[model samples]
Target: MTIEEQIEKSRTSIFKAVFPNTTNHYDTLFGGTAMQLMDEVAFITATRFSRQKMVTVSSDKIDFTKPIPSGTIVELVGGVKHVGNTSLKVHVDVFIEEMYSSQRESAISGEFTFVAIDEDRNPTTIVSYQ
Candidate 1:
């Protein structure tokens, strides 16, 4: 399914985190760091839906469109974009502050797949959204 398809009718979570002083150098957020945040957001969204812990199985693709500055608000949005027998594909959008304007711009976007696990650490079907 397309990116819009799954999220259009799926559940998700909206998480916000600020860039820490140690999170950036020269006031610019690092791409790797941004991607890690994206993954976490995606996991939170998917696992919350499943009502259990999950592990990332895969990611669709990611692109960095802008730079995030330190001391700015970073908006992390993630949602279920697709679901399978034992997995959920999620989409994440990370936005950075526009500094002076305090506006938000898309900094990075990624899609990841996560599988719910039971107490035994075995893969489990996330049937809530099904």
Candidate 2:
């Protein structure tokens, strides 16, 4: 497959149910929890894109635009945004969905950079099918 096709096929998404245990005092999904989930999704996206062992090196600014209340559903979507020799960036977005309706809105977004590594944990080049 072409590089574009590989990246397109690497797109990953996961759905989660917001529960009271994950909410904060404001009864909304905790920022830290959302971030953890985003990072996980980003990691998956990077791995899927390259089929390599990858580790997150950094995370870009994360913005929370809306609150995700408890008892709701959330969908996290992740995709490869940029590719480099040994590193790549994945963009992740969290969308809040009403359990009883079709209403959905973007609640958070962020970018994470990951570096491909070899068995020795050293940086390795990412092979692309161009």
Candidate 3:
């Protein structure tokens, strides 16, 4: 497969339902919870793209554009944004959808950097084996 094909194939989307337990007192999804979900999605995408043991090194600015109320469904989309020799960047976006209505909007977005590691947990180069 080509590098473009690999990147395209790495695209991932996941859906989650927000419950009271995962929300704040104001009934909105917690920022920390959203970040955890984003990081998970980033890890999966990075692993899929590199086909190696990948670890998150850093997360860029995360913006919460809107509040995600409890009882709503959220879709987290992750895709490869940049590819490097030993690391790559993944962009994750969170979209909120109302449970009983047709309302939907972007709740949060962020970029995460992941580094490919070997068995010893040292950084390694990522090569696309076509």
C-alpha lDDT of all candidate models, in order: 0.74, 0.95, 0.95
- lDDT, candidate 2, 24-110, per-residue tens: 999999999999999999999999999899999999999999999999999999999999999999999999999999999999999
Question: What TM-score fits each model?
Answer: 0.76, 0.97, 0.97
Candidate 3 regions exceeding 4 Å error are none
Query: Could you tell me which residue pairs clash in candidate 2?
Result: none
Candidate 2 is scored at a TM of: 0.97
lDDT of 1 by residue, 1-130 (tens): 5434435544554545455643656567776777788888888777666667799988788987876767777778887877777888888888766555757678888899998888998998766533
Q: List all candidate RMSDs to the true structure.
A: 4.0, 0.8, 0.8
Query: Which regions in candidate 2 have their CA more than 4 angstroms from the true location?
Result: none
For candidate 1, the C-alpha RMSD (Å) to the true structure equals 4.0
- Please write out the lDDT profile of model 3 over residues 32-110, one tens digit for every residue: 9999999999999999998899999999999999999999999999999999999999999999999999989998999
Question: What TM-score does model 1 achieve against the real structure?
Answer: 0.76
In model 2, state the lDDT of residue 29.
95
